[model samples]
Target: MALLEKLTPGSGSFDNREKIQNQAVSQTFHSAVNFVNHQYAKGCEHIDESTTVCDNDILKSLAFSQMLDRRCSIRKPHTSTCNWILETDAYKHWLQQSTGIFWLKGKPGAGKSTIMRFLYNRLRGECRRSPEKGIALEFFFCARGGELQRIPLGMLRALLNQLFRQDPTARQCIREQYEEKSSAFGYGERTWTWQPQELEVLLQDAIVTAAQTQPVTIFIDALDEAGAQFLSGLANYINQLTTAAKICISCRHYPTPPYIPGVEVRVENHNSGDIATFVNDRLKIGYLTEADSPDSMIWEDLKADLTKLAAGNFQWTDLIVPLVGTKIAEGESPEEVRRCLQIVPDKLGDTYRRILQNVIRQEDYSQTFLLFQWLCLAQRPLSVTEMRYALAAKDMVKSPHRIRCHETASFVKSDERMKRRVNAVSGGLAEVVQLLDGDKERQIVQFIHPSVNHFLLTEGLNLLSKLAGDGKELLAHQTSATEFTSNDTVQRCHSNLYRCCLNYLLSEETPIRTELGQVPGGSELDVRCKSSPWHEYATRFLFKHAEEAAKYRVEELDQGIWL
Candidate 1:
């Protein structure tokens, strides 16, 4: 779609609109759209024959680039967790295997990803200890995070990227594919379609060509998050890879065991000691202090009770123990905190509700809820800076509400101030986490847990509706900013997001020149839009949100958009 955007009919070809005839303009517009559409269908471009560029590096990034540092990265084994997995004979054998897969399976919160990280770090250490291993590649997939993290094309590209980066000479065939794809073949008769099979062949050929004498291992987390077709293809391809390389994967148990020979390592059983240590450390953090307490149970008994309740699932313990500590810190006596823990639901959904109920304001629930809604519904993750501006935008066409934050974003000039505003807007529900994005670093606002997305979509929406009924006026604004659609919570969130984005876009005070040379008054400030992370999201997804919102509230849709 972005490729077609460059060919936008009359945009560049005939820029002097005042000089052009109406009929000519109309003809140019249709021609461009039609030409791009036809090219898109054919998967070809009409660029000059000599305009080819060596773009394999760009192709490698199509997915893998998005995969880099997409999370609050986990770099090592949990401090409280045991390292017995590394010492296990089964795991040791799996790692040493010339070719085959080591599959790690577990329930939702059984610390599978954590274990995967542990293994990845250990493998990295091995590579460092002995340089002959070349490089060990790792990728983590999140069902709730990004399109790249959950799709096959991205995963394949990530693998291909690793192969090319670790050993460039290995991708001779891939190099050819890259050149051919970019070449002006057949005078633009048929465009080169980037099918999954295309990369599959290159990857297979690249791995086959590596002639790696040193056994290398690849850790790919969350196969269950990827498409079934990709999963099956990967399973088959890796079967061939096992002849020289070892592959490891962590995912939720599904689709039965692989028919291909593989090593099965269950994460639940290995996590008991780790879970116990984690819980004990959490309890000792603040909940066990002698300063205040009504509960008489011994520390040992408390740990045992919590450990038993966790039932080999790290996620339940992860949320519950911290929640208890939070409650104790917030003025609830240790005795009262322990009492509440007794009734707190073991399920992840219940834990989320308890947390939200405590922190989410009943009066301004939808506005705050919109923050989470935008994070979940956004086509891509929004950074803390982006969310700050998003939360503050008020639709001018409507009876505009004055939402004055102590801080407002001037994206280029006020990045530091925006961080504080972002935290205020998040209200502790969403948070800013640093991700190691290749050579660069970035902060992204994401929910506490992957499961939080589902909770907000279903139970959380119901709670928002109930809370929105008697919500009070916003102290930050002249009147209450609780805008909610009674029947369509999802659409309302999207619509609100759409309006906010439009307001953000409209709020721009100046435009920049894209001419080859800078204009007299042009500075970095003039090119603020070019530097902002939110610019692309605003440009791409604004209308998508509005389009979706119109599905449920077409009449409520602002006519100003057309204008």
Candidate 2:
């Protein structure tokens, strides 16, 4: 009788039970409504406003130098390009899915990175416009960059950091976890490190918790570049996350991903129109855009031929289009340009080798070779200013009589001019990019593509050496420096760099200035960089290069040590 009475009307326990059920239903209904409304809304002015985080230390710790270097370096997709993917059923379905995986596969030099950048930007824009529940994050894997850029651990840390920024609850969870781990390890903030397992668990937890309220989307580029050791496990984990989040990964066709449950889009299959449009726009031929022109058919045919030749390799098209444009500008017939394309090699490596041979003359060989060495083996990406100083130091090292630092004014002229010079010397294999270093902007040099870096390191280096002749004085401290065996090329390069760093540091003419800069509000480091760009790099990496040089024990080091 007492239990029946408690369950009846005016019973406190029954009223509480009914209220709890109603709250659960209401929460579910609101979540569903928010999701559908988000999908249908074509335009929105704000994404979920919860992503902003005030905890600077955690964010800084999670982000590493050069984390965004590769992404920033990618060329923006041309207008009207990469729009085909947005209309695809697979893409639309993936976007609507609460949890899904989308894979974009391509051949090397097929413009996969460019496509990824386009998609990331587009999605980010969409989320920003939608005053709904969505978060967008991206990471571009750079094989030629620091270890963190090419590893799974770095990817996890970056993604988790981004997640914490967007989700306050997750951020609080991270802060608590960080404190607990610090206490357990008895390590100060400086000594604390994030292990991979802990990050993985935290990411899973964050995703699950975040999904209850909103959608999270992540774009990862160049999975093949990310270390192969963890790719299979990583793919599996990502697949599991599809229960709550959406992921898109781009990778080269080879070293195929171990798991294959995701929707796969072959880059070449869908990018032919984009290639044709790019060629037509970039070829610079007359009447190419006029649909009604009598001669337009001829140009269209020409564009088609080049597009077919590209075989979905946009990089190949990019190289050929400019060459064709140059030929046409020089008054060469379209037939001649077509003939030129026919002779060019189909393989990207060979294509690069050919471009290098054509652009680098005998007099420019040593500088070109040295530039490649620096790009391939530097401790970090070189800023434009540092590269200019490096090349200058090389010449000064060769002819000590001219070992004087030029004024900053002289450098200012070369800042823009040097970019052209670098392109000319490197056959467009290396390019300068402007990116943010905290609040400051820096122009750094990197290879046009990772394949270019690989080619130079493996085949291009030896080819340049053979072409330049054996025992050549390549940035030698002394004329009679040691010859480089193919086996010791890497070490010899490091040794040469070590020597250069020493010459740069010990040279009495080279100023390591301490005065405040003319530019107001500049940091001390910025002032130092403006006055002497190479000083910071040479000081920081002198020992690092020296250690690498020790592997071969170059005699140059002994001379450098004494000098």
Candidate 3:
């Protein structure tokens, strides 16, 4: 009313009383909107202030870099229905209750992440519709992203950060912990990470604060990826936290979390329809171009066989769907594709083998084996550009120009050749895609699925080695092919990797447009060279990888490599 009075013309009196009243009504509505906007801005400022006290310069670097918006990718649209759980009475009960834990468990490639992502999005949408429901904290664990993304400390900090964004006052517990650590030996004398116990206290404080107004939800996906330590005693923490908040989590079934009273949903039982749908849709987009006109009987037959073979595994569908495209994309009739599908098995291992047999050309066998060996052994997924440079590295014994007065670059600048190399070697098993590392785009090459990772690390590499005809295994897996720990393969792969890295690091650059050591800007030129994707990786990891490799000296390794 005051704002309208200040803005209105001739407030004291109006010659046309009826027109004045109408103008006042419009001004009053505008005044209300202005007040709301002002309050919103003030609220935002308050949140910014509160979060600062909880922030640490180092921990800030460890902040959930891409997590805030990193939803589980179904990869392609309509690929995951993920609605089975929502229809259950248990899910409905948990929603209305709004103060319990729910655990969804599944196998490695059973689309657990997909289901969890769907639920997270659905809950978020509901919150947006009625924000009075309070804030939701969601984090998807990525094992390849390093410790900051897949550990207890990271999880706590991310969860706390999410809560602080919603209720500014909820940061009190974290602020106290920050101050305690800072003041232990004087201000800023010591830096510390929040232990799980301390984090639990802080989480409790946040949940209580948020719950005072409305329900708060926590969604954690890929618990197994966080490692066994995260799994231990996690259920107890969640059980305790849900005393004031609601939580949902999903992980593989091994090294199982503590048994807590909650709705337990097994993924495979609920995913058969979704897997079939995904298979049908994917093939239609990429494979099934021609109709019954070519071979109507087998086309339908292939679809039925594929959906049956899937057996509720989406990863199986992923490998199988592309096989349908191999012949079809080349303008082969549906008859040819059907014949190809006939030999591909329902089992993951057999299917992976078939794909390998197709892509491993007779001549490219050794090259592809070496390429895959580097991939199977890399500590982290190598960028496509990194793989290109790494692939072209020459062993110390193999290089002709061992002694040089001046250094040359590793390989000639050949972007087109590198792309073809990655395409041919990756086959359909690996993906070369643009991923954002912080704010910049990076092109990385990695296995298309976790099953691919398993197969390669275990049977896939061995299969390739068998084709190599040395009858030698690079590394051996335990009783279970999928288990990654306590294996000699790590050493075997690392030694070869060390030699590979060492060579790539030492290889001289052959100057193309610019002369060797030429610089447009002195120190700035060095910084620009440091910016090459491969340059920093080689510089950083060359020694570290060699150290891991040195632990075990393999007889097969070249003596020159020992240098």
Badly placed stretches (over 4 Å) of model 3 are 1-80, 183-193, 285-294, 331-563
Which residue pairs collide, candidate 3? Answer: 292-296, 408-508, 408-509, 409-508, 409-509, 409-510
Best candidate (score: TM-score): 2
Query: lDDT of candidate 1?
Result: 0.62
- Please provide, for model 3 over 209-258, each residue's C-alpha lDDT reduced to its tens digit, 9 standing for 90 to 100: 77887789999887766665566666667688888888998876543566
- Give the TM-score of each candidate: 0.50, 0.52, 0.51
Better of 2 and 3 by lDDT: 2
For model 1, the superposed segments whose C-alpha errors exceed 4 Å read: 1-65, 70-76, 80-82, 185-193, 255-257, 285-288, 291-296, 330-335, 342-347, 350-563
Task: Give the root-mean-square deviation of each candidate in angstroms.
Answer: 27.8, 22.0, 20.7
Error of 1 at 229 (Å): 5.2
- Clashing residue pairs in all predictions, respectively, total 2, 2, 6
lDDT of candidate 2 over 1-563, digit per residue (tens)? 65445446666644677768766866888899999867645332222352222255567768898778999999889778999888887788877777778988876677889989998988889878983748888889876789989888888888888887787656666765665665576644546778888888888888888877778888999887765566688778777777888899998654446866768788878999999889878875563344455555666688778888776778878766877767766666667867777443346776577556643556667778878888999998898878887776565444425355453222334688888778767755677778899999999998755557766766677777665554565555546434456778788788778777777777643333334323344455455556777878876787789899899877766762443
